[model samples]
Target: MNVSNATIEDVLNRLTNQTKLYFQRDNNTISVTATSPSTAQASPGQNKTVSGLITDATGEPIIGANIVEKGTTNGTVTDVDGNFTLQVSGNAVLQVSYIGYLAQEINTTDRTTIDITLAEDTQALDEVIVVGYGTARRSDLTGSISSVQGADLTSRSTQMLSTALQGQVAGVQVTRNSGGPGAQGTIRIRGVTTLSNNDPLVIVDGVPSSLNDVIAADVETMTVLKDAASAAIYGSRAAAGVILITTKRAKDRQFSFDYNYEYGIDRPTTRPTNGDVIDWMNVQNEVKWNDGASDPYSQYSQETIGSWLTNHAVDPYHYPNTDWMNLLLKKSTSHEQHMLSVTGGTEKLRTKSTFNYQKGDGYYESKSYERIAGRVNNDYLVNDWLRTNIDLDFSKSNAISPSQINPISHAYLASPYYPVQWEDGRYADTKDGENPLAALRLGGTNRQNYYKFGGKAQIDLTPLEGLTLTAIYAPRFAFTKGKKFTRAVPLYYENGSMTYMAAHRTTNLEETRND
Candidate 1:
């Protein structure tokens, strides 16, 4: 059209398809434009190629942005340049998305190219959190409540349920009575609230139970209701706070099994060392002289004292100055725990069962604990309007220790000059000496066995929308049997001979309790 020999009027006259082209004249040049291609007029049944670029607010390309046709899986991912091409219906709507960004939809009504920008999502502030007997959004909670997940319990080597929370939560104090095997600590939230009893209310799977019977392996979540407003639902029983425990439930799956085991050694943190025979005699002499009396130890000549000091180590049975602390206590004790669980579910029913066994030896001989526990939880959707749940748990524990006085206290109080055994293999019991090792080996014995069982059955009927009629019945039973046997022997003098007019007595006690 710009030929030097052809005039502008002549070129316009020779154009046969003027309606399909448009011309515009500028100060220095002429421009021509043609109609769009046939792909722009494609129908729903026809497929067309669409391409686009995606970016964030900072104008930087977003890698791996998903470009998909609405309601379908036909999609493509963006390249390093934030460009993507996909084959889709001409009238299709695209769903563009990326992680941590809000998704968007765009319509491709007569276009072949699209450009999208996504904004970051900020919906985590409204996340739902678990509360007492229900769940609420974080924004709706006004009282104090602390929650601990199952993962936190799995990493610790705690055998008792209450020991797992030691030092893990604020405002919660856990104190163990002693370093004895299977010792359970006391958990007090926000300090003591009552003068008589400061123990918090422990609820396991909606059933009131002792914390010792609840195995740590079966717990799914532990929530503490700390404030009065949050614990008001429990009434006067929750004056010291409330501990809600929820056990693991069966998931939607076929059959699954899990096993866990732990084994470790236990030892006392400190051992007391007392003075030997020579030191004991010298102290006894000093005490007598200080009391305005002559030395009572003068009855034993200098030669006897020198012999005791020389032969105490070589002939421990004859002239023994034994270290009762080390002789009566072991270097270290051992403990073992095992847990097994099975879970299964179907379209209308789900069930879970677990079994746990634990055994621990105390630092002293003849002191130990053994326990076995099992639990079963099941739920069934009988029909569209009827549902039911069943839960059953049983535990049996046996604890054995000295009935009268603990061995550690006896060892510290007993005189060090007393030998553990005489030369004739008889327990030594002099006029002024009490062999603590004899009390631990042939003294009083106490054994206690406790059995607990709890069962719950619940029925729920949904008669209308947002309304449910429920009924629950839970029964708990416990039996404790304790046996005590004390051996009373005649008092002996310097030799292994009973005193004149002395008699031996034996007593046996059996106790049974039910609740």
Candidate 2:
């Protein structure tokens, strides 16, 4: 059947004609009469059920609370299950009282179901201070080994494990000359350990390594070996102190998996300040002013300064004032990072695996980095006397550089009057000054590639009761390969660039056994 829309009057007429009336609820009070002497109906009571579960603020369950119908002296209490049920006489109130839980009172009405959630009393919920190593009553710790744990490392997309450690660990220092996945950070433990070799020894899963490829998400703990007792295990490499990095491995009898993702833009924390730029400009003017001229800016007469200011500052857009620094820096597009982890184990064998990917724009022009990595940590009980452990880590990365060219020379020595490009727009440069941008463009994406693997295995043989022999093996590798360029410019004209364009990689390995 076809139907047409109707106006308000038409809808009202149809409803009035077709609608039927029914019995209405009487505005009457419930009778207290039992109605019969043999089979009697009970009257409504004064109290209502105060049904609630008692729990601590941390969501932990609480048990054994006294619950009863108040004034009538009739009520039941919560059992070991932290739950209670009760019935009260007419108009009786209910009181819920518990030693560890706050006491609550409620009035009864014409209600069937009443539920309550009780909170822990102040005396029971008092704060308990924490002590590291093993929880002592905060008042017991005498030694100092600061603990740092809070912000989620998985949320931070730094490609290197060490990068995430910055500022979080006190007395432990991480220094990086530039940004990139494999750009090594000079790590020192509790200040410099030795006058000479200051770099602390890196230990992966309790085994020493000259180069350990660590994925940020896989790292669970970083402990600095400050004193002699901690350093004794490492021996020679420990002379400069020790850096122990522990990866997240599987726990026996439990199976777990997690996938975390984050997308964020990252750049320099502190850029070249305004004061730095001013100082640089002063140095440049002084360099030109030293050439027998009493005053600089003579090429553009002093009269031009007032006019330049009036025109530019009065209406900025109308008369442009060039700010090279602002033009050179901008917030690039947001970066994206994703990670997947799987860990599980049996009593005999435990295993862990993690995969991470990250990409972000670099601070300078034509710069960025992308990395993909996979790590597996495993433990196996070969026999009661024999056990083995292994951690395999591998990462591949590509870093995009602005130019392998001389950035400093182009930036510092380039003539302020000439600028980076002339009015003609062709790339401009001098014999002494070269644009770092050009050098970077020439080299393109010069990558610092890395392929790191750490393996550890041990054997334990019991020659007698409580007497055993152990053998261990570990190996590590790291490679930093890329092109660094410097053209014949104002800075590198003749004797200027001997130390420029120096790119070298360092690698190391370690192994041990005892009987």
Candidate 3:
């Protein structure tokens, strides 16, 4: 056991000689194999040198094909001529593998020369990816682009298409700007490229649009152009990056209808912790004493603090350790989404329609978001050389929240000693005029409403064998309306005394814009 000065080989020899074990050394490590009296004298299997030519199903040579011995680390790759020579034990299985091809296992039991033919993996290589202005097979594209299928986007419960795009691609960063309901994340491709706006140009079905305007369920494919060369078609608008989105269209002679519903809960994972009344008063007194002050910094005296600690359990309404976070926020907010899609068409005429509705509540009370969107796409084959397509999309959304004060920030600043409400159902006064609960319940309302309508028509004419002429017309209209109403709130002390009015005035403001 104490072989500090012994070499590895010497230790291994000692271990092998003392027990019925055999050691095999490989790359600075020794592996032990047990040996018994019945098979201890058996001879090792003989290794045979096998040479083979690997080819695809088309009878073409496939260079760099991997030839690995089954259940072992012995492997070799084919040379330029698709010829590989590997030494393997008798009765060994030769596993042949290549990219974009199905692997095959050949049993080289009694043969010295073997030939393998690997079939093309059509499912892996035949995926059609949408690129700029057109589509290409996955194996044919050589650009800096990443594709996400619609099935993958709708696999999870997400309110925004941008939210579902997070972690779906490489070199892309999706950061959320806020934690409010139905919030969309800001995406940055290959890091920040400009100071003003780094948002990628979003193109939906050949028309410039917003990511939030497209429903996740309606997406057929989402492709991101990471490099400048791949996004060169958009000119300066694609200086940051580009995101091409293609919505689903009608299939040939197929009629299908689908309805999907999702429900999710949102809760804050972390919250700021503030000291209780006793701890606050103690810290205040300590700060004043350290500052060489004659009296405590806080208005409450030591006797009052002691009385609060003693009677807070029985009389919580008067001397309470109020948790502003819990008072301002609910335990958990919920969101729900519903989608309905109808697709029916023939070989000449095709049509697809989708409708989506979503409602979500923010972590804070009295904060909510709602949206409804619909899309319709139609394709017409007028003749052998003429084809027409039409697309229409519309959406409306409303976001409501408190306008007077930020409830979250105010919650962190509000003192814990103050009670949310007095025993007589009156709002309690805080050192600061802002009470998060009061601001949420009685403060002004900030409502933002947005409406969007987009229409596109395209005609394709083929006059020659390989010549085609195309014309497209797209028009988009958007309307935004904002309304805010501020109301005054009065606070009362425990003894029914009046404090300063919180807002002190009433104001109504409305704004509308068309684009």
Task: Judging by TM-score against the true structure, name the best candidate.
Answer: 3
TM-score of every model?
Answer: 0.70, 0.56, 0.78
The C-alpha local distance difference test score for the whole of candidate 3 amounts to 0.84
Q: Which stretches of candidate 3 lie over 4 Å from their true place?
A: 1-99, 103-123, 270-274, 289-307, 500-504, 507-515
Q: What RMSD, rounded to one decimal, does every model reach?
A: 14.1, 15.3, 11.9
lDDT of 3 at 509: 65
Model 1 pairs whose backbones collide:
none
Candidate 3 per-residue lDDT, tens place, 289-398, comes to 78887786455687888788678889888678887777776778899999999999998999999999999988787689999999999999999899999999999999
lDDT of all predictions, in order shown? 0.78, 0.56, 0.84
Over 1-515, each residue of candidate 1 has an lDDT whose tens digit, in order, gives 34468866556434525555544445657656564344336888999899988999998999999888998989999999999999999799999999888999999977778888998775744656566666676567788877777678766776688888887777889999876767889999999888877888888877778877788778888888888975567888888988888888887676999898889977667666678777777777777767776656654556777788678668776686767778777889899999899999997999999999999988887798899999999999899889999999999999889755577876666677666656656666733435556656666678888899999898989999878788889999888988877666434554556632111244446565654
For model 3 the TM-score comes to: 0.78
Q: How far off is residue 56 in model 3, in Å?
A: 6.1
What order do you get sorting by TM-score, best first? Answer: 3, 1, 2
